[model samples]
Target: MTTYPPNIAKLFEPRPRLKYLEHIDIAPKERSTPAVSGLSGYLAQLKSYDSEIQYTPTEGPIQKQQRERRERQRVQQAKVASDLARWNPSEDPQIQGDPFKTLFVGRLDYEVTELELQKKFAGFGPIERVRIVRDQRGKSRGYAFLIFNSEYDCRNAYKESNGMKINERELVTDIERGRTIKHWQPRRLGGGLGGRHYTKTRVWGGRTNTFGGPSGPRSVHQTRTAPRFGTRPAYSLRLGPTERRPYERQASNERPERDPRYGGKYGVYEKYKDVKTEAPYKYESRDSRDFRDRDARVPERREREPARDKKEDRTTRFDRSMY
Candidate 1:
């Protein structure tokens, strides 16, 4: 009899017995039994185990990590390529003419330099030129124009830039098609001074001259001389107080009085007054005393009176034959 260790014997502890009668005298297969198979299989497996299966080297771990990273990058690149293929430049037609020459409005970053702007927009397409309208001091006015080689590029730029907020302000991109051209015209300075009334001049350094200097000639020292008109004698027309002009005063006085004949103080009264006073007008009331008295004085036609029978007597009869 082969004696087994207690740990191995626990695998084959008998509980219920089988009563099959194929071969009563034959012993059970030793290799097929749990006690014999369990320990023998473990021993064979341990003898065949390699040390590489137990631990991986540092380089192997690094290579596995790098493989995972490369896979992620490839996936990202594939997605970007897919997006680029779907982008349509010609579906929305570009604005006609040179895009770089076109003006734009509503930029956000005033401090953003031209190079920075170009670089930012270059992601959309090739930028030809960028101009920021500035003050005399060359400070940005929060608006700028970007030009591109193609209209498609401009359209893309407009799509990307419009309503783009920078420095807390939203950009408003537009095409400046109808901007008015401004010309620098020299202003006439002395034109205001020559009028009959001494017109007020924009005083420059205490001078009454409209241009504030000599009218035409330039001094040898290049300094502007005082205007000659200031020294010229001005004629005065003096009038005594209460010197009432017969026609002027009457005309002025009669003009206001004539307004009352039409109606009241305001011009509105004339319409109401005409409707009340005018005869043969539809608005004149039939119930008025003037209408009643006029109707009473005019005799009624005898033919219009109620007819009486021949046998009936007519009282207070007047002669109809009198013309």
Candidate 2:
């Protein structure tokens, strides 16, 4: 290589623009994030996955476990993606009945069949259809959709049936998100309200969640809904017990059931009516056997006490030690 002349070297040299007048600051290009595509959204979920996967002919215990975990995560994530893809809120064939009358049931036990769910929830309101979401292999995905005949019934079930335990799994109820809620996505799409995957680091929502939310069914039910499952009857404190409006149900019966029990919301349903309980007017069963208690060779009213004079007779301060 040879040095060029001054004029030629000057031509080869790049000219610099004045920074004050024309130069503009260019931002550094941002690092592009990995795109998730197809039926595999689990790529976003892998916190401990390796960037460079290396396979060994001979396997150690840790390596084998890691491999298995990775595979399991992949499969589970793929299933989630597939579910998201299959269910379209706008134009999906699987979704039947009115959107307003459909209730989304989540956190279901896979073993809980549709019949069992219907049986347990029937007390709430009459159901039109019960659909348990299943994968391509026909295995349960642990969620369901219940279609009620009326919107009132659907809302009642959503409010009252939420957190009800069936098959040892507490249920989570929601309105039909795809149609009812605008721009809502399922948990698989990463846009549901609550989740069961609350760890020590992140508690989104659960029974024992650290955020101190409602612990179980009782708390949620009492806070939100009336005691009974169906439509609440109109009543006033000024009115008598039998003066309240009848419960106009969309359930099986055409005639509304008139509840006459006198009290609060719990005054409606008599859960223990079938139970053979002792009469409220009558005292304890032990009252009938008072004679047996009197013959127990023990004094009653209170614990056996020393004679009043003996109690009054106190030893002197000097003689107290001797007593």
TM-score of each: 0.24, 0.39
Local accuracy of candidate 1 as per-residue lDDT tens digits, 146-165: 77777776777666777766
Alpha-carbon shift of residue 241 in model 1 (angstroms): 66
Model 2: per-residue lDDT, tens digit, 120-220? 87887899999999999999998999998889988899899888998778888988878987777876676777674333332222333444343454333
User: Candidate 2: where is the Cα deviation over 4 Å?
Assistant: 1-87, 197-323
The count of backbone overlaps in candidate 2 is 0
lDDT of each: 0.52, 0.68
What TM-score quantifies how close candidate 2 is to the native fold?
0.39
Report per-prediction Cα RMSD to one decimal. Answer: 34.4, 29.2
Steric clash pairs (candidate 1): 100-147
lDDT of 2: 0.68
Error of 2 at 132 (Å): 0.9
Q: Which candidate is the best by TM-score?
A: 2
